[model samples]
Target: MIHGSVVHDPTGSWDTKAPLDRDAHTALATAVLHWDQHTAPAPAPADVEQTALLLSGYLDRLARELHAALETLPHGQLPVRDHVAAEIALSQVRRWLDGPSGAFQGEPLAQAQSAARLVDTLHHAVDRTLGAHPPTAT
Candidate 1:
């Protein structure tokens, strides 16, 4: 059995609980940048707008999940290897937000990009935590 005081994997499966919604995330990213590729862009398609909204909702969820994963570890200690990936993902999201992509660029694209980044980081953090080898029984 997986060793941990809190068996929080809701599914009770051996695999990590956090799964990246890559399809939605990819769609959001594409929607965000699609307008830029057009010379004279028309209104965003219905699907694009919907994707943005979905991403926003997912981002909130992702944030919560990340917070929970971080809490699972001992105080001030982390699975360094996995945690590093999570950190990188967080930094990537931050960069995307602070960059022009975050400004929304007069559209939902920037916001979508920001949401995508959060999701990306969330996945990284969770993967690292769940994959970590628990402290061996002494």
Candidate 2:
């Protein structure tokens, strides 16, 4: 009798579908919360610094993942708007990460908050863009 292959790999080559790392997601929430001006008992300097570092690392990783996805997709598969949005979001994160003590200068928390928002935006934009181009049937 004919039989299917031993296993199915429904994902990127060696990458599969890389979900946002749990630690990064948690850092995102923490960064956003601590950076909020309304949050009582403001975060300590170390907390803010740590969050910023995590955010920077996540931004770097997320941007690369998004780029790989875009590169691998078939041309014209993703909507123009969605593609542009993802690019813009990526730019937002990349710009911040690249800048050494950007405009937020004396405000790392503010920077971290911005990074969190940018990363979140990039994450959603990539999801939307990729979702536009669903995987082909096996």
Candidate 3:
């Protein structure tokens, strides 16, 4: 069943709750599966440019949220090693955004790549902070 199902609650009490970590993992996995099935290659230049503008705004919001989450980690609780790993991942993300790989690609490709890198960084940080496995390689 999907994470939220009316049938699961027969009592009609609408007692819904947000997903916990495991549920989140499952949902993300399902989403990736669906995306893989449905997504096609990058679109034409006009569409790409329009999409890029929107994607850039979304990425900015995501970056802010990531920064906030990073701040919430307890000082001693966040291991130096994990921080270093996150730093490395973030650097890779930046490189992807700034390097030659970003130049020739259509705007859609560029945007998608940028978003993927951010997701990678986010996953790494979340795994490190929660002491959980790096989420099942979606």
Candidate 4:
């Protein structure tokens, strides 16, 4: 049984075929939420490290999925706007990776805020990407 949230077609107005976009958006939203939850505070150093590692893995997976989706698109069919949004999302993840450990080396409040911002950025990008590609019947 398919037990999960169902995303409506993005291009329903135009009656385009957009199964891939729907699936991608759903997956991206899931990842963003997972990161947000794990990144919250009150953990030991070891636990924080583990959480970071997991988030890194998730980011890597997302990158691979985005790349594959981009690869599958034909030149004309490629959603340039979506690609740009995804790129921004990827850049935000990279920033967190490169950001100083000290930046998150404060109280749980600060850490949670930073993490939340990152997750929000990711969600925004995913939403933009999903909206950028209208469903196309191909």
Which one is best on TM-score? Answer: 2
The 0-to-1 C-alpha lDDT of every candidate, in the order given, reads 0.59, 0.71, 0.49, 0.52
Evaluated at residue 26, the lDDT of candidate 2 is 57
Between which residue pairs do clashes occur in model 4? 17-136, 17-137
Please write out the lDDT profile of model 4 over residues 34-131, one tens digit for every residue. Answer: 44344663446556554445445444445444544555555555466667777777777766656777334655433444554555566555555544
| 80 Cα displacement, candidate 2 (Å) | 0.6
Query: What pairs collide in candidate 1?
Result: none
Angstrom error at residue 43, model 4: 1.8
- Candidate 4 at 11: error in angstroms? 36
Cα TM-score per model: 0.50, 0.72, 0.43, 0.44
Candidate 4 Cα errors over 4 Å, as ranges: 1-41, 94-138
RMSD of each: 10.7, 10.5, 12.1, 11.6
Q: How far off is model 1, as Cα RMSD?
A: 10.7
For model 2, what is the C-alpha lDDT against the true structure?
A: 0.71
lDDT of 2 by residue, 39-65 (tens): 565578787777777777667777877
The most accurate candidate by lDDT is 2
Error of model 3, residue 97, in angstroms: 7.0
